[model samples]
Target: MAARFRMKRKGVGEMLRMPGMEAEMLRRAEVIKGVAIGLSPVDENGPHPGHYKASWETSSTRRGGRKRDRAVGYVRNTAYYARWVEYGTEKVHAHHVLLRAAQIGGRNQ
Candidate 1:
C-alpha cells in the first residue's frame, strides 16, 4: 500500500526565518518563566520553599511551522517529595502549586 500524500520535514532555521521571530519567541518564554518562578505558593502547610524556589526553568528554539509554538517555559521542584506535594501520597494532600503556576503563567503571556 502507498500513502496518498507526502510531506517534507522542516528544519529549525526554515521555521524561524522570519524577521526577529526567534528573539520574540525567547522573550515570550522569559516572560512565562518569570511568572512561573514567582508563582509557587508560600504556605506553612506545604513543603519547604527552598526546592520550589530553585526549580523554575525555560527554553526557546525554532521548531515547527509557527512562531507561537517555539517557546517552552516550565517550573519544577527539586525536593525529594515534590511529587508528594503536587500529587499527594496516601497520607498527604495535593497542594497543586505547579498547576496554579501554569495557569497564572498562561494568563500573563
Candidate 2:
C-alpha cells in the first residue's frame, strides 16, 4: 500500500497560484518476519506425550448452538497466531527450517 498526492486546478485564479513543494520523509520501519505452520493429517508425532492426538482433535464441546462451535474454532485459530514469530528470532528461524524440511519430505513420499 502506498499513497500519492496531486494538485488539481480549480479555476483560472488557481492556475496563477504557485505550486507547493511536496516532500516525502521515508523511514526504516520495523521489519516483521513470520512463518505459517499448517498441520496436515500426516505430520509426525513427537516424543511429547498426547501432543499429536490432542492437536488433531476438536476441543470444543458439542453442547449449545452451532455458532458456539464456530466461535470456538475461530478462537483456536487466533491462538495459533501466538505461535507466529517476528523477524530476527532464532526459534522462529529454526521452526521455519524444520517446517520446510517436513514439507519437502512429505512431497517426496
Candidate 3:
C-alpha cells in the first residue's frame, strides 16, 4: 500500500539524544547531595545534629524495575531528628539546608 496509515506527526523518532544524559543526571544527583551535606550545619558532636547532616547519605541504584537501563544516584537522610532540623522543632531554629541545597546546587547540574 502506498499509504499504510495516516501521519499527522513530525519526526519525533529522530530526535537528538545525549549519550551522556544518564551519566550527567547521576553526576548532578551527586552534586546536589554534596551541596546539601556541605550546607548542613555542623556541630561539635557531628554534622547537623538536627539529622540534616547526620543521616544524609548517597547511593547508586537503578531508577525503576527494568523500565530503564541507566543507573542513578540517590541521596537521603534517615535521621529521626532530620525533619525537626529542617522544619525546626518547638525550640530549635529552622535550618533549611536540604531545600536550599536543592535549589542552589541543582542549578549547577
Candidate 4:
C-alpha cells in the first residue's frame, strides 16, 4: 500500500478575503490604534490638550472586485496637526508616534 497526498489550490488572493483574515486585520488595527494613542504627544499647556491622542482611530477595508480580494487595516489620526506631529516641522521635533506604534504592533502580532 502507498500513502496518498492531496493539496487544494486556493491561491493568496482568495486566502486574503477569508472571514478569518478580515477579522485578524481588524484586531491588529485596533491594537495598532491603541499603541498610537499611547504614543501620541499630549500638549497639556496647549488649548487642545490630548486632542491628538483622542484622534486615534482604526478602520479596515477590503479591496478588489465585487468579491473583494484584499484585507487592509488602518490606524489614523483625524487631527489636522497629525502630520505635523508625526513628521514635525523645523521648529518642532518629529515624534513618529504612528510609526513606532505600527512597529510595535507588527512585532506583537
Top of the candidates by lDDT: 4
lDDT of each: 0.60, 0.27, 0.66, 0.86
Which 10 consecutive residues of model 1 have the lowest summed lDDT?
65-74
Clashing pairs in 2: none
For residues 41-103, what per-residue lDDT tens digits would candidate 4 score against the true structure?
898899999899999888777663456668877788999999999999999999999999999
Instruction: Rank the candidate models, highest lDDT first.
Output: 4, 3, 1, 2
What tens digits encode model 3's per-residue C-alpha lDDT throughout 1-109? Answer: 5958664433322221234444565677778888988888767686545555656776654442254444556667787777876898789899987788889887886
lDDT of 1 at 25: 60
Best by TM-score: 4
Give the total clashing residue pairs for model 2.
Answer: 0
Q: Candidate 3: give its CA RMSD in angstroms.
A: 7.0
Question: lDDT (0-100) at residue 109 of candidate 3?
Answer: 68
- Per-residue lDDT of model 2, residues 1-109, tens digit only: 6898676645533333323200100000000011122332222553443332233222322222343221111112222322442122555332332244335533543
Weakest 10 consecutive residues of candidate 2 by summed lDDT: 23-32
Model 1: residues >4 Å from true position, as ranges? 1-13, 16-26, 41-49, 63-74
For candidate 1, lDDT tens digit of each residue in 1-109? 9868655556554555544666676666666557656755555675564566566665554453345544333334665666776787899678776677667766877
Q: How do the predictions measure up, each by TM-score?
A: 0.51, 0.18, 0.58, 0.84
Q: Count the backbone clashes (under 3 Å) in each candidate.
A: 0, 0, 0, 0
